[model samples]
Structure formats: structure tokens, C-alpha cells
Target: MGLGSYLIYIALLMIVPLWAQSKVKNTYKKYAKKATSSFMTGAQVARQILDDNGLYHVKIEETRGMLSDHYDPRKKVVRLSRDNYHGHSMAASAIAAHEVGHAIQDEQAYAFLRFRHSLFPIASLGDKMSIFLIIAGFILGASGLIMAGIVFMGFAVLFQLVTLPVEFDASNRAMAQLVSSGVIRNNEERDTKKVLNAAALTYVAAAMVAVAELIRFVLMFVASDD
Candidate 1:
């Protein structure tokens, strides 16, 4: 019965996400070799966008690792991976601009970003220990502990859901800025879209996995009660 009920969730949690991850990687690699017409490096594009938006206080810095780019709201810093920071490829420009979009979101007080930010500590703890708690609870046959695990995992699921819009909006902002600012030409817009869209699918897959996991737990809890 468990296998029958969870078949779809299992498929979604496994196949789709792996595919999305591969697609993003492949897409980024395909465009990473194509330099932008303007020949502006990722760091330059990011700086221009930030300055244009009056985000002079937001600093752009380099970070190690592929696709490690992110905006640290607490530090007011936009950290880009080495390739994105220094490379003048289409992939680099789009990604660097995307991180700046988050900075813009912070400056404008975007509600979803702010809410997700506020949940960081709780969600961090939940992500770390929820699995252990769930396993221990199941082993001990304790419904109370199981429910406690469910609540903890619930925060993680909520965070993933909230993150979807934040990511999409940031990508949208990135594309618009890239085009309007003349960082990317009209012909280059499609490539940027492909990269951003491929990246967005990863977040979608993540949200689906979180929802599926939460549903599986709820269903199991119900079956146990029955």
C-alpha cells in the first residue's frame, strides 16, 4: 500500500529533479562559451545594475565553486562564482544580474524574500535535524515524536514553496535588466532566458520534492492512526 500510494511522489522526487539539475548544468555550459556582444564581465554587469538601482551599499564579491552565486542579505553582499564574476559569457552576465535582482528585492522589501529570510534560522535547524528525528521516531514507534518531526519538516517545505516566487521574480528582473541595460542584445535574450529558465526548474523540482515528502509523512501518520 505504501508503495502504491507513493509511486507518483517517488517518481517526482527522483526523476524530475535529477533531470532538472542536468538540464541546468548542460544549458549553462552550452552558453558559457558564448561571449556577450558588449563584452562586459559578470562583475561589471552586476556593479552597473546595483549602482543604477541606487544599491551602492550592496557590495559585489567573488566566491568559489560552480553555481555558488547568491545574495547575502545580512551582509548586503552579492557573491558570484569565479567564472560568473570574471567571464564575459552570456551565462555569466545573466547569473550575475540574477544575484543583483535579489539585492533589488532586498532594497524594495519584497515580501516573499523577507519572509523567507525571516525563516532562515528555524528552517536551517529544521533541515538539519528533521530527518534524524523522523527516523528515530519511527524506530521508537512514537507518534508524538513523529508529529514533532513533521512540524519541523513542515517549515522546510514552506521555505521551498516561498522560494519559488522569489527565484522566478529575480530571474525575471535579471532578464529585463540585461536587455534594458544593453548588457545583452535582442538576439541574446533567448539564450539568457534558457539559462534562467533551466535554473528555475531546479527550484520547482525542489518544491515538488518538499511537498511530496510532507505528503508522504502525513499519509503515513494517518495510516498509523487508523
Candidate 2:
């Protein structure tokens, strides 16, 4: 609860992001080189899945990040990152299919993804509010402000929890569709699984960092009060 304890927590917090980033980058690179099945570009694969599911309105567009692909429920579009957008590898097919899984979720009104997307605005606001509330609480020496900060951070934690099911479902759908539709052969299943699993770990890593930071903030308030 003292300065040394807080410093250690902060240092640990810093490590997850770097480690997660490195793992994702390495996984993508490793699969990119080893991929042998080259049936379609990532974009083509995504579009194929979308059309196959009759989601004609859900457009697949390029976004500007390495492995930053995602589905925008609001825009009803799939955004593919640079590597998978044009890359023709098992990794690309998997990435593209994963985003499409989200689109499928939208069509079927999957509970978890819907909940997560619905919480986006509240979670975004709470994330900023938590910081301000915590700092103001510390400066004013008020337990009430710290309590409010905790509440605000609670939404951030909840968002992370809500994301797990959504992410896992997408990966499941991606792998299933790939296997069933003959997009990825049985021999290539492991490659896709490797990419998706590595990507999922990054989400888990982010959630852990948020939870750790929240604990550190709570410790600060408890220490100050003592």
C-alpha cells in the first residue's frame, strides 16, 4: 500500500502490454511464413464468408494497423488490418473469418457481443472518469470520490468480462466455418487455431492489466485513509 508497493504494481502493469504485443506480432509472423494454403486474400475470404451468410450489407474494408481487424456493429462493416487485408496465408484466412464471425453474431443477435457493444459508450466514459475521480479523491482526501472512482472502474472491469465470451465465440465460429466450408483443410486447422488463440490471449492480458490497475488504485485509497 506504500510507494514501493504501488511502484511494483505499476511496473507489472507495464509488462503485460509489451509482452502481449510481442506475442501477437511473433505469432502472426510465424504463421505468415509457414502458411501453405493460398486460396484467397483475406479480403476475399471475408467477403466470401459475409456473402455466404447472406450478410450482403456487411462490407469488408481495410483498416490501418497490423492485425487490428474488427467488426463495427454500429457501421455494420468488417475492418481488416493491413497484414490480413491483403495477405494470402492461413493466418489471413483465420483473421478474416474471425471478423466475419462477429458479423454473424450481429445477424443472430448474440447476447454477449451485443452486450459488449452496447456498453462501449458507458465503458469509454467510465474509463476516463475513473482516472479523474481517483486523482481528485487523492488530492481532496475524500473517501467518497475514491468510492465513485471505484464504481466507474467497475464498468471498465465489466466490459473486460463481457468481452471474453464474445471473443471466444468469434474464434469458435471462425474455425468451424473454415473447417465446414472447406476454406481451411483439416491439416491447416492447427495453424488457424494458433493465430486465433494468440490473439485471444492479448485480450486476456488487457483485462488483467485493467484489474491490476483497479486494485492498485484501491490500495492507494486504503493506504491514504490509514
Candidate 3:
């Protein structure tokens, strides 16, 4: 019964995240093919947004790898993937704008963003250590080790929950900037929103997965106690 329950739980957790990832990729590809009417390349859009926001010191650079765009708050650089940096599609523009949104958050010192940044190192270590601790605890019948594992995993879960708002807020900022800057009209903004929303769902799926994992482990610890 335990084994069967575990299998079911694993299956349930996997489904939503896999589907969400596929949705994000498909939505992005669909919009990537449709060029924006504004004729503004993503790099141009990012630069304009930064300049308008008085973030002239932030740099935009093209990086290799699909869907690898991100804002490096430490370096104050907005990194865009190859296609997003040069392509004029709604997808490209929206993705670039979203990263710039992070830069905006940095400039404003958004609380959640700052918290997420501070948690990065601890979360990274916790993620790697949790599996080993859980496995060891289960094998050795050590409740204390198991509890430690749960606490470590809890940090990761907290990071994920915190990430939800940061991501959603970034997307919101992206949409507003896209509209207000004339980078995209209302109809085009709809397409951009679709892309951003699809991307946001991936983060939601991730948080769900993290929460499920934490719950699963806590249940395991309880069962072991019994």
C-alpha cells in the first residue's frame, strides 16, 4: 500500500508540471512565429524600457541557449537569448520585457525580489542536501535526520512560494511597459500577455511540485514515526 501510494503521488505531481512546461514552449513558439507590428527588435525594446525607467546603467546582452533570458541583478545586466535579443516577434518582445521587469524590481528594491535573492545560496545548498538527508534518514530509521531533511526542503519550498509573486509581478510590469511605451498596442498586448501568462504557469507548476514534495516527505516522516 505504501509503495502504491507513493507511485500515485509521484504521478500526480509529475503531470501538471510536465503539461505546464509543454504549454509554455508551445505558446512561445506560436507567438515567436508572429512578428510584432511595431517592428521593434527585442534588444531595442529592452534598451528603450531601461532608458525610460532611468536604468541607463543596466546592460543588455545576447546569450546562447533557448529560453535562457534572465536579469542578473548583481551585474545589472539583462541577458536575452539569441532569438529574443534580435527577433521582432511578440514572444521575443514579451520575454525581453519580462527580464527588464526584474531590473526594475532591483532598482526599486522590491521586497520579495530582495528576499529571493538573499535566499539563493541557502536554497541552493538545501536543494542538494535534502535528498541525501531524506534517503539516509529513511534507511537508518533516524527521525532526527528526517526532520532535518524536511526543514531543509522547507526552505526550498518557501523560496518557491516567494517566487510566485516575483514572477507574476514581473509579468504584470512587462505587460504595462509594453503597452505604455507603444512597443505593443492593445491587441498586440493581448498576445504578449498570453506569452507571459503561459510562462508564469511554469513557475506556478514548479511551486506546486515543490509543495507536493515537501508534503510527501513530511508524510513519510510521520509514517516512520508510527
Candidate 4:
């Protein structure tokens, strides 16, 4: 049963992300061609929302990448991909607003976002080291190293867990801002939400995969003991 469960989790780890990415890509592709009623570029929407939220210091910068939009809390800047920064489509508006939502969270000192930020350094290190440590532990039959690896992996899993609420809240803030700032109309709200929801699923999928990996590691540790 344990082996079967582990294999199932392994399958999920492989399948979930691919499914999530497909949803995001499909949803984005569908909406990217659908122009917003306001016809405002993503930069314009981001600028308007930021200014309205009294985040005047938050700068909007264009970046090169697909789906690389993010808010740099340290730099106090909202970076949008070239497509989002210049495009005037539902996908552009939704993505821009979602990133600006992170800016708003930063300004408000959102608890989850702050917590996630705090966890980033350790989580990053753990993410990089945990797999190697686990593999080495298994190879050398060192239970202590296996336990240490599990602890490190735990931090990464915790980070992923905390990231969920932060992402969901950002999307919520994005929708509210989009509506309140008149960036998207009532008729367009559904489609905008579809875009954001699809994006959120990617995060959810990632968190699930992280959790499953942690469980798999724990199971491995137990099996090693026997």
C-alpha cells in the first residue's frame, strides 16, 4: 500500500503541473486575443491601479518573457512581460492587476506575503539541497542524513503551503481592483476571472506537488528504518 501510494504521488507530481500549465496556457491564449472593452494597455491598467492604491512609488517596467509578470517587493516595482506590458487584452489586464495586487499586499504588509518572503531564503536553500541530501542518504544508508533532508524538505513544503493564501489573496485583490478601478467591466469580469483562476491553479498544483514530495520523502525515511 505504501509503495502504491508513493507511486500515485509520483504520478501526481508529474501530471499535476503539466495539467496546470496546460490550463494556464489555454486560458491565456483564449483571452489574449480578446481585447478589453477599455482597450487600455497592461501598463496603463497597472499604473492606474497602483496610483489609486496610493502606491505611486511602485514603478511598472517591461520585461522579456512569457508569463513572467511579478512584483518585486524589494525594488517596489511591478515587472510585466513585454506582451502584458504592451498588450490591451483581457489576459494582459488580469495579469497586470494580479501583479499590482502583490504591490498592494506589500504596502499593506500582508501577513502571508511577509511570511512567504521570510521563508524564501531558507526554502530556496532547502529546495536546492534537500534532494541531493536525500539521494546521498539513501545511497550511504545514513538515517541521520535522511532525517536532516526531510527537515529541510519540510521547510520548502511549508513555504509552498504559505504561498497559497498569498497567491489567492493577490488574485482576489486583483479582481477587486480591476472592478473598482474600472479597468474591467461587468461583462468582462467573468473572462478576467477565468484568466486569474487559471493562473492560481498553477500555484495550487505546485503546492500540491511539494506536499506530495515531502510525503514521499517521509515514506522513504520510514522504509529505510525497516
Query: Model 2 scores what on Cα lDDT?
Result: 0.86
- What number of clashing residue pairs does each candidate have, in the order they appear? 0, 0, 0, 0
Per-model lDDT: 0.93, 0.86, 0.92, 0.93
User: What TM-score does structure 3 among the candidates reach?
Assistant: 0.96
Evaluated against the true structure, the overall lDDT of model 4 is 0.93
Error of 3 at 120 (Å): 1.2
lDDT of 1 by residue, 1-226 (tens): 4677668877888998999999999999999999999999999999999998999999999999999999999899999999999999999999999999999999999999999998888888889888888888888999888898899999999999999999999999999999989999999999999999999999999999999898888888888889
Error of 3 at 23 (Å): 0.4
Between prediction 2 and prediction 3, the one with superior lDDT is 3
Error of 2 at 205 (Å): 0.5
| Candidates' RMSD to native | 1.2, 1.9, 1.4, 1.1
TM-score per model over all chains:
0.96, 0.92, 0.96, 0.97
- lDDT per residue for candidate 4 within 201-221, as digits (tens), equals 998999999998898789768
State the number of backbone clashes in model 4: 0
lDDT of 2 by residue, 1-226 (tens): 6789778777668887788878888988888766536477889888888888899999889999777788998899999998788888888888899999999999999999779978888888889899899889888987899889988898988899889889999999999988876788878998889999988888888888888888878777777878
Candidate 1 achieves a global lDDT of: 0.93
Per TM-score, the best of the predicted structures is 4
Badly placed stretches (over 4 Å) of model 1 are: 2-4
